[model samples]
Target chain A: MTTSSTLRPGVGDRSVTDPGPPAPRPRGDGAAALAFLTPSIITFLVFVLAPTVGVLVLSFYNWNLLSDGTFVGLDNFDRLIHDGRLLGVYGSTTYMALAILAVNVVLGLLLAVLLETRMPRWLRGFFRLSYLFPFVVSASAVALIWRFLLNKDLGLVNYLLGLVHVDRIDWLGSSAFAPVSVIIVNSWKTIGFSILVYIAGLQSIPDQLREAAIVDGAGAWTRFWRITFPLLSPTIFFLVVINTINSFQIFAEPRVLTQGGPGDSSRTIVEYLYDRAFGDFDLGYASAIGITFALILVVLTAIQFWFSRRWTFY
Target chain B: MSTATTSMSPRLGRLAARVLTFLVLGIAALAITAPFLWIFRGALSGSDAELYRLPPTFDAGTLTVRNFGRVTEQVPYFRFFLNSIIVSTVVTAAQLITCSTAAYAFARLRFRGKGVLFALVIGSLMIPIQVTIVPLFLVMSKLGLTNTLWALILPGIFSAFGIFLLRQHFLGLPRGLEEAAKIDGAGQFRTFARIILPLSGPSIATLGILCFTYWWNDLLLPLVMISDTDRQTLPVGLVLLAGRFSTGSLGTIAAGITMAIVPVLVVFLAAQRYIVQSIASSGLKL
Candidate 1:
């Protein structure tokens, strides 16, 4: 997964880039190595590798959980082609992912840049703590909390809006607001991560770059555009890739908060897959969705890496 | 950034920028923190009515500690909590052992097809759980492990990311220490246990916290793997509580959520620097 950015030179060299004195390479440690790797090997083979193959095989079979799957050939994929709801699911998933990427990457960049400005040390810590705390919290728990707070009639959010004389918005109950509500919950929970990563990214940039820009009479906006952002491209690239992948698999938020309700307005692909596999007992069809989603991720990630080359500064 | 700008800007402009920065940061902070605080206060509120009341009250005098009690009474909160603890702790420990040993092999030892083996481990990171989960469920059922906590624990114990992280850490370590240990006639296990492991504490802590936080907060895995209420982890139990009692008990559910998040939040705040450092450096997310 980390190897998605292989197009970037020098990013993958951490393992072999040791500057230490070259001692004799320990050869023929195969027995010990095998002993050490046995647990991981067995588990990985059974859990990860085997199941990956299993998904491809399972896609061709129409089986429920109990009985043996009957060979269905390309029927599942055919069903997938005709599944009109799927386009909507993919739309919602991509919308969620892109919206999250925008919020996380853009707002996070702004917040990170702001935090880097002059402030009390404790204030900086407070900002970081406030933002990053939710990233560590469970998504299910967080979603439940948001669900409670996003309730149209009883939620604190609506209550607070009422205090300002705004009419109550159906945060979760409506097609218009359900997706937005999920986005808010997801973004609120995760934007802190982007802030923290971007802060680290900002810190790694040499002070002299910005200083040199200042000496050239570059204003704040210009300095940021020319000096700060270009240097932060790699960080931007990293966050964009990871956050996109994570958000496309968005399940817990919609599952708990909306359950893809309001006539499937807020449904995502993974949520759709979950409904098919577990809820509807359509394992074969669900596997088709799974394989499709995985392919999209690989293709999308490869596209991101390909695009990153033009802007990602070394 | 501000200090650099001060030399070129007017004092008034700088002050305005500083204030504006804090102003924006203040609103963002409040937006981020308010939900957690509201939930906390709701968890401690005296009644559901108060929790849902407009112009929401956080009046300390009227707050009760009983919603938490209600959460416990309604569900096997402690059982779920204990299950979460057991799963997270065991998974962390297992990952430490498994990842470190495998990482050591990849880092220090030579073997046939090492490159291919390491690539296999690394390559699996790209496979999301959705792809593998259905078959994993099948495997668990075949092994008669579905609906058991083992279903939750077994699949999580091995992480390709963990091995990659610790392998990188091990590669960065000085080989002289291990060479010295070998010259002292210590076996590979003794050298790893005594020297390599001790020096790699920070990396271990980073990986340990990463795994613990991940497993503790994970919902989908437990939701799919453990169907039995007795085996359910906190996230699963909380979701069940939400689905089973959506309309009636927001306060109690808030309490359940607060309990789920607080201990982890406390530990995260305490180890904030290391966790942030690890994520920033390695791009590892829970």
Candidate 2:
């Protein structure tokens, strides 16, 4: 894959072994490169870079979407410190995110491991694709389907539960149940992705190691706990980081299923941010929340990366 | 006799574990696929009451396609579907063009501040949409593009992830073809368009499908940007439908969801390998 020779200036004309930085032919390739780069650079600046900076600046102002914003330094931050609802939102968001992460990683690993065992080819393929089916569907659509299926009185879930003499549980209405319901629905839609990733990670592990462990008379639990787990730590680390970032951003499930109802029990950060910016038109406060959440995520991701060195194998 | 018993017990235990694993996996797969079948079944039920019936009837004779018609008649389902198609298609195309070109520049050509510029591009990936949606909303409002499809399309057109993925693919390509093309008097753009892109179909398809699935299924952007019924995407439309009609028209709501997900499910099944590989690979490395 080395391209150092091709990158050397005038090397193709002279010889093939020269190594240097790329100098795309002297005939205005820089201009051509600029031409190639301009579209992405412009869009990235306008939509990503500038707006990122703008959100931070807007956090210091009082803009209600209709009028000019007056600079009101520290007021938004002051309010953010005291906002009781914000505290609950963060709590529930973290709770649900962690729950979803646990279900995804653990169940995903279990399913992937089981699938790795000897099975009929069609059955294996069926299980693999079945788990992934929900991942392809949109979150909102999945939520809508689950909303009907999880309804306390008439939904099929309760009906099935009733068949076993279990009482109906208010899945979407009760504050106690809303967050759990959200975790269930969200996990249902997402755990498949984790399973697929784990399967791929399992495939990458050499079979000889597992066979050698079997020859050593190590049982299934022993083999997994000792050999497979450590080898898959890097993959686990990757899924943890990814799932943490995505889970904290949960929006559509709670939005569609509960509408962040029953006293903000299931409200996620993004949904709350949406409510402030669009629903209440409290753009400044929303921007402050956004900035704070972003900062927290940055710190959290850094902490995870820092911790990974101690845990991740590679 | 004791030695035989010890080895036989271990073998029996292993066999039992294998059987349990097979049963557990079978049940889990059934549970996973059940909801999809449930949605499909609900969509076809002839009567709304049938959805609520205890030990729900599985009779095929009781099902019909009328609920699908009812879904469309009740709302602008087709309009939202059309909007989704247009927005996702345009965004995917825009990403392929913008990202691949930029990736080619990063991977093949030399430029000033290339390292810093590329770092900035990668840095954008860490910034979530929630952090920037406020100002983006204002920008859309200022430009009079609020409640329009362009509001969704514009922000989605450039993906830092797409650029990163494409650049990785481009960097792996052998330099012989490009150098020979250059020696034959082909321009950089000509060589890229003629030689590089054709060889990079899998990476391009991977990016395209990823982008399409994302924009097609995205909720928050459409939720914030498009309010007009005529402009809403399918996810937003499905949410609105559920909010308004979910109380009585369970079948109709299911019909709408089925319509929303079926095409994606079909495409996923057809390209399951690519979709799965893309997510797994992207997860591992990115």
Candidate 3:
């Protein structure tokens, strides 16, 4: 789309109307593009590209800042495989991520459908704004807010539970409950984004399709499932890809709340990786975990992409 | 014409559906905003331990600014606040200048290696900061940038997402713009500066806002890079405040959280309508 315009900026009739060869392009276009691209390319190389290579290489060799440790090929990878805690970490992380994704997709779709129905426009706008308001707040703040609210002794949640003569569930203090608490916290933090995206996706669907379905003696449920849901698949597919990747990188919520505590019940891979690198000062092992986690995300995203072909409708 | 004879059942059903919408959305909205409400409540509840008592009472007399005062007095709240502002602003500005230039090249210019370079740029998206943090940490320490704002700003100035976002918008721009500029004897640089940049204001603004928020809300990187408490960003600072108050009532930490989020809250409230709409439209593009 853009190259054609760049090639024939002023006129496009050179091949059709002119018998002579097309005019030679200006020598400055490539030069300008190079110069324009230089700053970002340099930054990308130094910060992004270089570190990517650094992690891959670092994973293969045991090295610290002060002493250059000897090379140990595949040892880091082997260690990651043998580390029994990894299975638990992966399980909890997947469970948490799937819970988060389910909340985002299902609740997000529900919000979109609700807003699509009869409602005051202002009310819809206000809720949308309020929902996204928490998103702008820093992750640490969200963590802190939830920490306060879920305080088993004095938190508003437990306090309200006490009002109804119900025992307060351990929101963060217990192993079994911490993962669920962070899921709720993290879900609250991120669900607005998907809801907004779904709203946008909902708007893109044509009204006539739903109208035709209804005219053909379809109930509301049938119309939605057969007509609207299939049409919203592209958006769903996009969110699934984006959110799954994001959910895998869950760090701050668990880091700040459970600290992978109550015996690593809420431990995410990123958090475990963080502890290995920073807490243990085990750079090589951390790099290995990093590479492994990155590969998991890449593979999962690729698989999602492959599956999307069957379900995603343009 | 027969629509005026609609049965009461359908109207009642519609009413039930509308009421259900309100019921469901209202409950969801309540659950969503519950944290913010609790934060506000905790921020207001000071030494009055009743706020911490089971079946807490939120009396007007219990509200106090003592915890806010404590937060400011205990930690260098102002320094952290200023550091966040400066770091996020510089990152945002540098990104706007850098990401757009690169995006323009990928969108409008055709070089021999454009496709490969663009793919590499997209490839960077798969490499999250976690994967790069250890090496970046060492690199920063080597360069003596570890406790400075430069460590935060410089590494963040390059973003694959920013480039991707702007490139998509630039590709959709009308071809007549650059053609008109070229017909008037404008060179590539002149056309890009005068016509293309002006026309891509909304895309630039969206990217700028996103980058700023991303930088501002950053915790993990700052936690790794900035060890000196004096140089820490607000997120790090909040965590530190929490650690210090881990033993006592959470009032002071709540106050610190409130302080940290206030600026972001203002920014959000100011541009919320525009941000939400732009986010939606950008979704369609992606």
**Candidate topping TM-score:** 3
Provide the lowest-lDDT 10-residue window in model 3 chain A.
A1-10
lDDT by residue for model 3 (B245-264), tens:
65775788878888887777
* Model 1 Cα lDDT, one tens digit per residue, B179-202: 886665555666677888998887
Ranking by lDDT: 2, 1, 3
Which sequence of candidate numbers ranks them by DockQ, best first?
2, 3, 1
Provide the lDDT at A102 for model 3: 96
Q: Estimate each model's TM-score.
A: 0.90, 0.91, 0.92
Error of 2 at B241 (Å): 1.7
- DockQ top scorer: 2
A200, model 3: CA deviation in Å?
A: 0.9
Model 2 alpha-carbon drift over 4 Å, by segment: A1-29, B1-8
The collision pairs in model 3 are: none
Q: Local error of candidate 2 at A64, Å? A: 1.1
Error of 1 at B89 (Å): 1.1
* Residue A161 displacement (Å), model 1: 3.5
